[model samples]
Target: MIRIVLIGLWICAVALGTLFFTVKSHMPASGDAGEKASYLGGIDYATTDVFSVPIMTDGSVAGYIIAQLIYTVDIKMKARITVPLEYFVKDEIFRQFYGSYSDTKQVEKVDFERVRKSAIDGINRHFPEPVVRDLLVEQFTFMPSSEIREMNMKSIGKRLSEH
Candidate 1:
């Protein structure tokens, strides 16, 4: 009876030890998840925003900019945005910023300085409570109208040749 009880307890101990080791090995290490890994290692997100700025033809501003004619021109653009994992963690501010930026019609270009200032101001204003270590802009491309047409033509030619 003593031998059996000792063997049973020994088995239980071994089992518990194995289970603990397995769980600990499988669990993520501290700061080893998601954007933390990328940010810490200096690996930037692969994302971009592409847009066009219509140049002023003649002296008159484009109809889209009649009232809003500031130092900057209106640009039609397509953005390839990567939502950082950190941003997703911010429920309220993230939702507001996401909603505001989702509209293609609302996209416009201001002076680069103005844009920079506004972005800095926004970060200062909203991110005070939360600890965000880094926000990175991975890429920005300006797609001209001519380049679009040329790319379309090349794509079409390639398709025709393939067929």
Candidate 2:
């Protein structure tokens, strides 16, 4: 048993070392390639919790849009801002979805590029210098109210069967 355990540990160490070296070899060198690398050290990302917006049509809740956003900011400049960055991102996402619903009368189609542009522009408007570098949409999903009701009904049925 002891010998087997020692062999397993050695194998794990070798695997880890191989993985590390492989990743290191593929990493961009600090030269011309470094210039093209988007994630240099000076930038930091702020991720927002999931935001949900109820789409309204004809004075009733038509569906729901769920989104998660990430915003990149300059690390040095982030400290100067008083309010948290996530708040602005969440507000912008909500506005984008809400505004789109109003303009198109449905949330089936989304212009992701427009959302990103508006988010960066909207947040930057408050500050003299542009603080938000870019906006990233990690998750964006839509579910109709009827599907939600169906899901709820199924869940209720399952719970009742369990009891």
Candidate 3:
């Protein structure tokens, strides 16, 4: 039993060492590549800053969704642009978001997955060829209207000053 345990431990150590050696500096920042790929498989990936998506009600802004997005594709993805492809993707992101008319229509509830799919579809339509394999919403925040922020700030400020 002791000898078997020792051999098992040795095998684990060797496996771990090999994994670290192979992945070091090669693993991209995020996501699961599984046995098929690394993060984007070391392919070109684009990310966006937090998008303040306005939620409209009664023809006015009701709330906002702070969304950060990621676009991942295979290493073969290419583009013809003077600016970094990320920036170009960023511009297209907003265009696709607003083009859905979500800001104009009163969206009482937000389905993030639905929004993500719509955005992807819109972007693909804008592009003659599909460029992104997947659209990942890394961060999604639902912020209340500006009126709420001011009221909250004032309440906090009043309490802070009292103390």
Provide backbone clash counts, one per model.
0, 0, 0
Positional deviation of 96 in candidate 3, in angstroms? 6.1
* Tens-digit per-residue lDDT, 1-163, candidate 3: 9999999999999999999989886865455556456443546776776667565565776776577878875454454433454555556555544435445333435576776676667655545576666787788666668766898999999999999
Q: Once model 3 is optimally superposed onto the true structure by TM-score, how far is the C-alpha of residue 80 displaced, in angstroms?
A: 3.3
Question: Model 3 Cα displacement at 143 (Å)?
Answer: 1.4
lDDT of 1 by residue, 108-145 (tens): 44243544345434543443232333333333233334
> What are the models' TM-scores?
0.33, 0.71, 0.54
The Cα local distance difference test for each model comes to 0.41, 0.82, 0.65
Location of the lowest summed lDDT over 10 successive residues in candidate 2:
97-106
Name the runs in model 3 displaced over 4 angstroms: 1-42, 83-108, 146-148, 155-163
What's the C-alpha lDDT at position 22 in model 1?
98
Q: Residue 69 in candidate 3 has what lDDT?
A: 78
lDDT of 1 at 70: 13
Q: What local lDDT score does residue 17 receive in model 1, on the 0 to 100 scale?
A: 100
